[model samples]
Target: MSPIYFSLVTILLSIITITHATTITVVNNCDYTVWAAADPGGGRQLNKGNTWNLNPAPGTKMARIWGRTGCNFDGNGNGNCQTGGCGKLVCNPGNWGTIPKTLFEYTLAQPNNPTDTIDISLIEGFNIPISFSPTSNSGALGGNCRTIRCTADINGQCPQNWRVPGGCKSPCTSQGIGTCGANGDSRFYKQRCPDAYSYPNDDPTSTFSCPSGTNYRLTFCP
Candidate 1:
């Protein structure tokens, strides 16, 4: 190919790369307001029945999203939350707020791998009941993404040591507890929501994936 034609092809490819996007919609299904937070993205105040759509850079990996309850932010989006606060209404890039937080983690599709990996994580702890799942298109495109959720009233059931204002603390975060799969506390979470990560190394059964460009819905209190 000639130099001019090669340059044109390169520009076309770059445009295509930049234009391709994936979306993760955050929905609040609880009866109260939730400060929906995300790393690599940001945070949004989602009222009951409201939603916020996040479009992170393609191939974004090792990122997380969670909810903060009992928040009081100023007009400039600065304040604290009773649970899962990062010191501001909008969290800085790559910031996973302090626990107790019910974390939603994921790795979007990469160039070589057209599948997205995701999981619901209680490693930090649990606040609101949450669910993470791919939209209907996953099955339509031959993707096998499955929904993962922790809908039990963890705060009410948590041990006294792990109790927080708006959430439950994981033994893993509060202290160096036993492996999530073996500990009684972790067992409590697992028995209620078997599909989520009770501890950091809880993979195999916790990690899941979907087709490339698949859309996702993260529902709070689902």
Candidate 2:
């Protein structure tokens, strides 16, 4: 092959490689405003029935998304939220959402694997109902690439000792415990949301994977 032809082929392949980043769409189905927050994309407030889309770099392996409710932010992006508050409009530079919130977690394309890990976690306790689903056109890689959710109203059913201002506190968290491995507290969450991570050690069936290029749609209050 000619030198110029080889150089052109190399450039084309690089373009394809750089364009393989994943796209995530967050939709708010609640009747109230929800502040959607993510590590890479920062935060945005979504009024009822609104949506926000984000595209993270291909090398971004780990990320978490959640919603902050009852927020009162000013023009300067400083305010307090009832749940999952990050303290700013754009939560960056070491700001992460508060506890007692439903989380949509992700592990994008790794070095040796072409599949992405995705899950809905309730180990932190739940404030709102959330769900994760692949886009209709997304070519799922494994049989486990199905929608996962925690639609229960955990806050309402939370034990009196585990109740918080606007969220439900995990029994372990309420009792100042760590790593509830097969304990009664962990069992409570597992029984409610069997597909979610009830504690740190809850794996196997909690984690799920899809093809690297698959797009995902995450819904709040769904």
Clashes of each: 0, 0
RMSD (Å) per prediction: 2.8, 2.4
Tens-digit per-residue lDDT, 1-222, candidate 1? 999999999999888765456788999999999999999778989999999999888889989999999999998888999989888888998677888888888898887878778898888888999988777555544444777788987888888877878888887875563544457767888888898888777887888888767788999988
Report lDDT per candidate.
0.84, 0.83
- List of clashing residue pairs for candidate 2: none
Candidate 2 stretches with Cα past 4 Å from truth are 1-11, 136-139, 174-178
lDDT of candidate model 2 versus the reference? 0.83
Ten contiguous residues minimizing lDDT sum, candidate 1: 135-144
Q: Per-residue lDDT of 58-103 in model 2, one digit per residue for the tens?
A: 8676788989998999999998899999888778845767888888
TM-score of each: 0.88, 0.90
